[model samples]
Target: MTIQATNLGFPRIGARRELKKATEGYWSGRLEDGELKDIGRELRKRHWSLQAECGLDVIPSNDFSYYDQVLDMIAMLGAIPERFADIGDGKDLTTYFAMARGTDQAPAMEMTKWFDTNYHYIVPEFCHDQHFSLSSSKAIDEFLEARELGIHTRPVLIGPVSFLLLGKLRDEPCRPLDLLQRLLPVYRELLQRLVAAGADWVQIDEPFLAMDLDESARDAFQQAYDGLAGSGVRLLLATYFEGLRDNRHLACRLPVAGLHLDRIRGNDHLDELAAELHPDQTVSLGVVDGRNIWRSDLDATLELLEQARELLGQRPLQIAPSCSLLHVPVDLSLERHLDDELAAMLAFGRQKLEEISALARALNGQGDQARSTFEDSRRTLHARSSSDRIHNTAVAQRLAAVGPDDVVRDSSYPVRRKVQQAHLNLPGFPTTTIGSLPQTMEVRRTRAAWRRGDIDDATYRSFIERQIDHAIEFQERIGLDVLVHGEFERNDMVEYFGEKLEGFAFTDNGWVQSYGSRCVKPPIIFGDVRRPEAMTTQWLRYAQSCTRRPVKAMLTGPVTMLQWSFVRDDQPRSDTCQQIALALRDEVADLESAGARAIQVDEPALREGLPLRRADHDDYLDWATCSFRLATSVAGNSTQIHTHMCYSEFNDIMPAIAALDADVISIEASRSAMELLDAFVDFDYPNEIGPGIWDIHSPRVPSSEAMTRLLERAASVIDRDRLWVNPDCGLKTRDWPEVEQALTHLVAAARTMRESTSQRHSA
Candidate 1:
């Protein structure tokens, strides 16, 4: 059997985030067009060279993107929304970016989490009359570019079926899948072009096969591939993030040259797949963990690969990462600050490639050649399993003591709402931010300086306090009823909490891209989580002192902290989440005791962490919702508890969302034009809700009239009195000028809605 080492995809954001700097510079007009393209070319060439150096035989091309791969596919298939038609043809950067970031004339396309990952993708908008054509030559160009660099790479495409499934209908009475027949010609043409450009194999990623599918979807997949059957290039169909449980026969029987399975997530059907494989087809085993930082347990993984090899005698077998390495940091060696002991247990993108190559050598009967790598993996696994740093008996005992009452609030949401409104009386249509204000260059510089010991504690604290003063003054001046402390003292929502909490470790440069030009260095939860002391109390107290308006104490919720962190796989995720919840519960009690009136625990990742399969949803949601309640249950009825979620499909999880029992919930709505509110409307969500009026993810500043129109749409679905005004998410990514402009419009929209409501009541 021929054995090879391959990669599904690589992180497009460079090790030091060069792409972020270049993209943002280009967006700000600091970099010329040629300069931006030069940077992208340099990064791609460097990435290809790195993979080749690591001994990967089947490197992937066209996996890189300026924004997201899905958006790239949209441009490739000419699926640009009608609003962007006048900008240019779908090929230019102006129209491409306009669809992702929005212009003064059009709002940005809707964006949400890609599957269960924190990586966001620009949602495709499809009209009933959507036309399909080969709009961009990115795939063909990248394949030829790799060939020029002496890398015969496999070009990756988002499979036609999965692409259509990932999109939403712009108008009713039309299905995105119905456009499949029209979309297939574009895929076929792209494959033909790649074949003409000297490509032999193409990896078509159909990740939706891992999710639940109907018969129609299965039919669509058959139709899509059958149309491309004779495109003259070998096709490697890839599925990841899950296993094809029921769709196994469909996937295995597809008319493709090969099939790649995520052996990590869905390994139960491996033997079944081996039994069902056709003689002409190859099987690629995804053995390495692509979404995590932990080193692979190579001994066990080798055993699994050997089992597959035995079942499929003399068949071509490939070893690769379970999915794309885009979810992980680019390099582990750059993290010098992490001590040697802790660092030994981790693997980044480059390290994962080495692991893949080692596995392939072992599978190829060259185990002795890769002996040192195998020995290192064995030692790391042994060290991690036996590490004393992993377990905390005290934390375990505290978690054991948790009871049903711990997850229950003292009163229902209605009772708490009455008490909260009576104690903190405010005007109708109250406006608040989703925690953070802009963390400007000064704030970032001060924090960095303090970390580097260039500035003393007093100086940093004084600077943070001044920034808080400015934020409070701005809110009060803008006539917002509720306020936030701006969170200038914090670096990230998750990392800030993890720094104060025990059982967590951090890396100086373990950055992963969340979305466009946005990178997050997720903290690593290596042991039983425990709060060392009060985390945000001092800052919240100082901010409240500067403002008469009730300042909401913002904390990252337990689920988000656990979801965002690189968690230890030693224990069940639910247990670590519970430990985190208990820690946050203590913080909630302390903040309430410190005279904080309202507390917002942001759980934006709660929905992002939902299990992809429907059968597993209940078990995850139960523990997830329980964890959130366990954190906020300590708050008194008069102490308002709030939560925030963004860029998620809430339609399926509306009941679970209600189970959290937060007094108020704010969600992202502006990008979808308040369409996400339909879930709340259909469920008749009882608690107060702040359907966001401004899309903070985009750089464009919205006008008061636009925000007011969105509020009107929200009011049509939700009660006006129960509604609040807020931005879709935090303003930390945006500049102060746009934030001030956007929130000014937000407050104005609230006032306009309040006046209209009052007039209607008088009438």
Candidate 2:
């Protein structure tokens, strides 16, 4: 076997979040343009060097991004939307960031989760008369840049077909796929340049292949690769985040020199691939998991490869991590504080790359030479299963005792709706802010000081109290029906809950990119989860003390916590989630006792946690929704239950979402406007719905008239009594001015609609 090693993609944010800081600094005018680009260049050079040092045969270039790769592709193709293009052709990074973040005058383009991952992508907008041109040479430039460093790298591109399919039709009379031929020329030109620049191979990612493709998408894949067939560049057609499954025949027929399969995610399809793969083409077998933090079982991976070798021979094999390391934290070795046992079981991006290299050596007739590394991996795997931290009998007993009644609310939504309406005295179109207010620079500064012990507990508590007081005053002045405590005392929602719970560990410097220049440190759940005490009751009580309106108690849902954290692999994820839910159910009971009539449990990650394959979905949705119901069922019918979902395609999961049984579910709909609402309305969603009226992701404050227009559309589908108004998501990322302006408009819009509805009823 002459197997090689490669990576589909690596994390772009620096191991210590250098890119995040540099990018944010540039946006804030704290750094010059040249300095920002230099930081990006430095990060790329360091990543490429690290991958090369690990003895990988092929490293990926152009995976690095200041904002998003899809957005970069848009700029590269001169497909800049007219809103951002009015400033310039997006030839410079300024226009690029402007398109992503928006200028003071124009709002940024729509951004949503990238294929169910937390990573966000800027949505491309196509007009009816859209045409394409080769505007940027980033792919060629990056390949040449790597070559100059004495390193040969395969440049990665978002495949032409997937790119068009990923886009939404905005001003177009037709879908984006209608312009495939026009877009093909730009890709062809880029490929020709890469081939001219001494590139032998290029990785064109077609992740959309994993989705249920219609005939048109399948045909476009054939046309695209067939169009670029004559180009001298050898193509590695990559698919990850899921398996080809039904699309395996299409994969074999695509005219590419190579095929990459995610063995971790697509383990079931390996036999089919072994039978269908063409003898002439090479296959890159992704044996390690790039999306997780667990160490790979090298012996097991090699076993799978040995079988593949029997079918296709070692001459055609290449090893890699499934999908990209973009989802995991960058480096595990940097954590000097991690316990030895925990550290051994964990593998971040850097460690995962080394695992890929080790697997290659063992498979390449050097098993004896790599014996020590293999034994260590075996030990890590064994230690995780046998560790005392893996189980708690009490947790198991509690789970065993959970009856059907434990996973269902006390009453139906219609009954709860009448009880909630009578108890709360809310207006027809209720106005509320989502669970958080802006966490300003001073809030962050004080938090840092408190963590460092520069400020004592008393001091920190007082500081947070002041912040909450201010937030309550602001909400009252703005006339919001329900208010949050601003979440000033907490850091990340999941992280805060994890810190208070047993068997969860915190990282000091584990910053992972949430989006462009935005980062989050997901907690590490290493053992059995149990709450130490009430997580939100104190804050909920404090915020309610200052206001007569119902103070919303905010809690992160079990699925969101489980999905976001580095969970244990020793047990089924649904088991771990149920354990977390049992703990949260206690907290929910506490908050209700503390007089919080409106509790908003944010499950932004539920839709994201769904298994990528639809065949495996029912099993997941069954447990995921059950866990959520278990957490929130403790609340009485008089209390309003609100759950928020962030940017996601929730149409498929509407039934499961309805299963959550939240009295009110506030979803992100501003970007799609009233389009997402059509689903809820069409389904005759039994619960009250808050279709977001403002795009909180963008800093641009929406006008009352614009928000009222969205609410008007919402009312046309949903009953006026059932419609609640709010921003798309939390306001923690926005500044005070932005949040204040946006919420004012949101409140005004709700009030205007309420008056109009009253007029109709009176008439």
What tens digits encode model 1's per-residue C-alpha lDDT throughout 1-763?
6599999999999999999999999999999878988999999999999999998989999999998999999999999999999998779888988999998888889999999999999998898888989989999999889888888999999999999999998786878999999898888889999999999999999999888998899899888888999999999999999888988989887899999989878855666777787876888888898888899888998998888888877778999999999999999989878989899999999999999999998878888878988999989988888888888899999999999999999999878888898999978899999998988898899899999999999998989999988999988998888899988988999998899999999998899999988899999998888888899999999999997789999999999998898988888999999999999999999999998999999999999999999999999999999999999999989999999999988888999998999999999988988888778656988888999889987777889999999999988888888998999999888888888888888888888998999999999
Off by over 4 Å in 2: 268-271
Which regions of candidate 1 fall more than 4 Å away from where they truly are?
Answer: none
Q: Give candidate 2's error at residue 570 in angstroms.
A: 2.3
lDDT of 2 by residue, 1-763 (tens): 4789899888898888889889989978999999998888888889999999888999999898888999989989888988776786568987998888776688788887787677788888887788788888888888888898889999999999889887887864688898899999889999999999999999999998887888999999999999999888899999998888889999988889999888777754556676776776889988888877888888888888888778775437899999878888888878877888888888888888888888889888777767877888999988888889867889889998999999888889889988998999988888887887888889999999998899999999999999999999999998998888999988899998998999898776677777888888888888899887888888789989998988999999999999888887777999999999999999999999999899998999998888877788999999999999999999999989899997887877898999999999998887777678758655877788898888877767879999999999988888788889988888888998878887888888988997898899899
User: Would you estimate the TM-scores of all the predictions?
Assistant: 0.99, 0.97
Q: Who wins the TM-score comparison?
A: 1
Q: What alpha-carbon RMSD in Å does predicted model 1 have with respect to the real structure?
A: 1.1
Clash pairs of candidate 1?
A: none
lDDT of 1 at 561: 96
